[model samples]
Target: MTIANWCVLAACLLPTATVGLAKLASARLPSGGGRYNNKQPREWAAGLSGWQARANAAQMNGFESLPLFIAAVVLAQQAHADQARVDLLALGFIGLRLAYIGLYLANVDALRTVVWFAGVVVAIALLAMG
Candidate 1:
């Protein structure tokens, strides 16, 4: 597969990693009762206050972002766009998404939103690359 195609695959996998990080954040928290049940966990996580909360938000956003990116990459490939350009934009999208996760975890609110929008724009750029 092309580097961009590989990147698209990586992008799809990133959200699972992000969710693991979020779960790690929560697991680090002192459990008041018992070990994490790992069932209906959102309710458990909803009680998270600080870093855990932010991590949860980032995890959710990662899930929200994945499909758009996947669609963009697939559509671009189907449309037979320039491969190098798609690769560059795919890499850029991955970078922006990583930055978005960092920004979310750091509680950089305004900048996080900006990064999220930037990711959206990059996804659109990928679609336009088609």
Candidate 2:
């Protein structure tokens, strides 16, 4: 598979990893006070606070971003855009997304927004490259 294809996979997995971080946090809680609820996972996630809440939000954002990124990459490839450039842009998107997630978890809202915008721009660039 091409590097862009791998990036697509990475983008797809990012949300799961982010949500896992939240679940991991719940595992650290005492006496099951805020433990993950398998039967009502959405409710459990909705009740999260602090860093855990931020992690869940990041996960949702990751999912929200995936469609555009995936389409851009696929369209770029199908249109026979330069492979190296496509790969570079895909890598950049992944990097920016990782930074955004970290910033969200760290409670750095301003920087996170900036990074999120950067990632979206990169994905759009990929689309235009096609």
Candidate 3:
């Protein structure tokens, strides 16, 4: 696969990883545990506060983004977009996503939204290119 395609895959995986990160971070506390629970962890996650809460939000956003990003990728591929441009946009989206996650964790709400919108714009640009 092209780097852009690989980036799409990475973008797909990022949310799962973010959830794992939140779980790990949460586990550090008395309430959260490092062990993976058979029980739906969402309940435990819902009760989180502070950075864990932010991490959870990031995780949620990650999931929320995947569908749109994947659809854009599929459209771009099907429409035979300029592969080079698509790849660049995909990479840019990943970079923006990383920044968004960091900003979310850091509680930089305003800039986080900007970064989030920037990523979405990049996704839209990919669609436009397609």
Top candidate on TM-score is: 2
**Which candidate leads the pack in lDDT?**
2
Q: Would you list the C-alpha lDDT of every candidate in the order shown?
A: 0.81, 0.93, 0.82
Local error of candidate 1 at residue 114 (angstroms): 1.3
lDDT of 3 by residue, 30-99 (tens): 5334333438676777667777688878988998998888888879988998888888889999999999
Ranking by TM-score: 2, 3, 1
Candidate 2, position 43, lDDT: 86
Model 2, position 35: C-alpha lDDT score: 92
TM-score to native of every candidate shown: 0.87, 0.96, 0.88
The collision pairs in model 3 are none
Worst 10 residues of 2 by lDDT: 24-33
RMSD in angstroms between candidate 1 and the native structure over all alpha carbons:
2.0
What are the runs in model 3 whose C-alpha is more than 4 Å off?
Answer: 28-38
State model 1's lDDT.
0.81
Tens digit per residue, CA lDDT, model 1, 25-100:
5565566542244876767666666766777677778888888898999899889999888989999999998998
Residue 8, model 3, lDDT: 82
How many clashes (backbone N, Cα, C below 3 Å) per candidate? Answer: 0, 0, 0
